[model samples]
Target chain A: MAFFAAVNNWLKHFAYELQGEFLLALKTIAAVFRRPFYLPEILEQMHIIGVGSLYLVILTGIFAGQGFALAFSVELADFGAKNYLGRIMAIAIIRELGPVLTGLMVAARVAAGITAEIGSMKSSNQLDAMVAFGIDPIKKLAVPRLIALIIMLPVLTIICDFISLAGSWVIAKYIAHVTTTVYLSAVRDRLIFGNLFIGLLKPVVFSFIIAFISCYKGFTSGGGTKGVGRATTESVVISSITILVVNFFITKIVFSQLKGWL
Target chain B: MIELRHIHFSYTDKPILKDVSFVVEDNESLVIMGPSGSGKSTILRLILGLEQPQQGELIIDGDNICTMKEKNKRKLRKKIGMVFQAGALFDSLSVGENVGYYLLEHTNMTLKNVSEKVVQMLGFVGLDAEEIIDTLPDELSGGMRRRVAIGRALLSTNPMIMLYDEPTTGLDPKATENVLNLIMKLHQEKTIASIMVTHEIIDALRVANRFIVIWAGEIAFDGTLEQLRSSDDPRVKEFLRPFLSSFTEVVQKRFVEGIATENNSASL
Candidate 1:
């Protein structure tokens, strides 16, 4: 009986937290359409999340792309299909690697940053102070981050895809002994509309996941400095896992919708 | 006016305020005194509509905020200003920006006009606005931060009442005197009522017109200064014992000064 009671309490608490998270995300989306847009805050967040994550995203793209080309070249060479390296790299990187890698990296970097900044604000009474001053914290703080992430995540994904393709081209020419012209043509051939759409779509979905989880963790943070640290870590972990899990579902949906197109 | 009638508040399974009730009439200076975790600050948060009570009504100026919508509560908030412990200034903003935050965000006042108003408020709080306007909050001393917070509170169009939570807990003697004097001056000049929550008996005695003592989530005593001084309640006595020596010293010093004045006048 004691065991059953404990399990029931845990289930109830979990359901409560799940409901809170959904409400927070919905309020944030509704806030985006509300008045008092806070345009300057939105622009500042765009600069931070977009410009701040550029170098890291670029580095991740280059290395992942080069490693994929190097590894796949061996397998293709075994089958005397080395010229297909470009086509394989392009499809993998554009439809999968580029968006997922960018999403995870951003989940680590931007999500942690957003959570820490907001958690500190919460711990310090700024959120209450904002309310006391008749300002909505969601409108003032969360909306800018959500809007900025939505705009910048897709842009970052595109940049990552192009950089990754560039990195693979280098490996195909120098390391794989595949002719540059053949590899380039093979990559161009795989750059169909379906792959491009999926690549862009994934990051947009990932953006909402990262923003909602991080902002929710932040606004709910308590205790103090230790609580802020705990929330930041939780934000990153939740966002990264959600992105990976959601990526698979998004891919499944896209594959079904664009059946046989590739 | 503010009133809390039979308010009951709880967090988790533990009650923080149990059947607590009080009132502060217009232009009244009411000091809430209690030990740590005695639900003193909780009362202030409840009055601010930051937390809801499990049962009872919190009426501010005639409206029962417990039943009001969030939008109306926010509109009502403009009538009150709060000063948090640690100052709670926006760390990212400069002193001037922090002081002028409300006017800048809520009004159509241009930066130039807001800057002027901020400068005026800084002077009102006895800070050098010109010298410190551009400095971040972290750069200021503890006393300066508290003063900036006061300035921010007063800068609201016209706050009918001010709520201060431990405003001088960590300040030095000089800073404490400055802050106490500032509170007194606001009472005299602006005629704004105030509710101050503090454990500092000396500061409370200096500023309060009446006192409400809370013990363990319940109101133990409520009365004027003389009533409190003459009370035989052991809980009140126990709460006052540690600080009675310092309080006695202040009274003794004033007595000596009064005698000196009498003697000097007789000699003349």
Candidate 2:
């Protein structure tokens, strides 16, 4: 009887948590539609999540694109396939590197900040105070940041793709001494809008995942300072791992279906 | 208008409040006194609906709070104002912002009206209206922060009940008097029901119409202040013995010192 009771309680708690997540999602949607658009809050979040991430994303993009180009050039030269350097770099960054790098950078920078701020508010009763005052904290706090991330992450990924390709182009032309004409011709021949569109898609999904997970963790944090710390760690770890996992599944499914069309 | 019937609350495995019951009437001041860790604050939390009692009913103004839904709980909470032990003001917001938070969230008042009300509350709390209302919580003195917390609680004007937990703790004599006077004045003028938890026996006696003393997780004494003062119970006498002894010492020492000094002066 006790074992069955414990199992029943576990099921109950699981259902409760599921309901909470559903409510949160509904609240997020409602908040986006209800209030007058807060341009200032969106702009602030953009500056924090997008503009501040530029340096790290750019640095990673340069190294990743250049490294892939150099390594592939060496291997392909042995088979007389060195001319494919531009194509490889363009495809690699557009289809995978751009989204993955940008997602990881955001998981580190933007998601961590969101968790810390919301966690502090949770521990201090500010969130409760907000509820007591008839303000939906999910609307006031979470939705603005989520919407901002959705808008900003894809834009940042596009910027990263452009910069990474530029880095590869410079390395191919200047150091490897491949002609500028050949590099440009190779990229123009191989790159497609589908590649760019697929790259852009991941960041939007990543942003939503990151925002929802971090906000949920922070909002549910208990046990004060230790709880806040645990939430922050969980936000970063869970977001990064989820992004990687989601990226793989999305890539396989999207590319496989596209291949069928081809 | 708050009533608790046979409340039993615990944290983890230890009981904090067992068989605790009390009723607070409208416009009446109820002071809950007890030693440290006697669960005085837990009672306040239960009344605020921040915590649910394990095995009893909490009815506030004819509604059962324990069985209420979350939305209704929030509605009930709005009718209540609580001054936490640490004031618990939003550290990120300014004094004015903190006080005006509820008004901005709940009402359709214009910013101008909110600003006017903020100024009025600050003035009522004896805080300088012209001073920088944007000063952060860390910038304010302890007493000032407590006053701002009180002001924030007063923002929702005409809450059915006000609950204060250790409101006068960590204050100098003058500041304590200020807080005590504020509580009395708010009670007298607004006719708001108040439940204040404090260890300051004198302050409680000064403002309380009814006193409820808890000992070891039970309601040990419940009566008017006159009844409490005249009670012959050993626990009551033991608690009040320090104050009574101090009073007698002052009187006896003054009499003896006066006679000795006069005799010495005459002999000289």
Q: Fraction of native contacts in model 2? A: 0.33
Cα displacement (angstroms), candidate 2, residue A166, comes to 1.8
Query: Compared with the true structure, what per-residue lDDT tens digits does model 1 show for residues A1-262?
Result: 9999999999998798778789999999999998988999999999999999999999999999999989999899999999999999999999999999999999999999999999999998988888888999988999999999999999999999999999999999998998989998999999999999998999999999999999999999998999999999999998999999999999999999997776
| DockQ for each model | 0.71, 0.37
Q: List the residue pairs that clash in candidate 2.
A: none
| Residue range B1-268, candidate 1, lDDT tens digits | 9999999999989999999988899999999999999999999899889999999999998999999998999999999999988788999999999999999889999999999999999999999998999999999989899999999988964799999999999999999999999998998899999999999988998888689999889998999776877789888998988988886775566558768989999999
State in Å the error of residue B228, model 2. Answer: 3.8
**TM-score (all chains, Cα) for each model:** 0.95, 0.83
True contacts kept of each: 0.67, 0.33
Best candidate according to DockQ: 1
Candidate 2 stretches with Cα past 4 Å from truth are A1-43, A188-194, B10-15, B35-37, B199-202, B215-217, B229-268
- For model 1, the superposed segments whose C-alpha errors exceed 4 Å read A1-10, B251-268
lDDT by residue (tens digit), candidate 2, B1-268: 8999999999979999999988998888999988889899899888877788899999999999999987788788887888887677888788888999888766789989999999999998888966848888889877787788888988864487888889888898888888888888888887889999987777777777688888778987899765776778777676667677653554356458768989999999
lDDT of 1 at A33: 95
Worst 10 residues of 2 chain B by lDDT: B246-255
**lDDT of candidates 1 onward, in order:** 0.92, 0.83
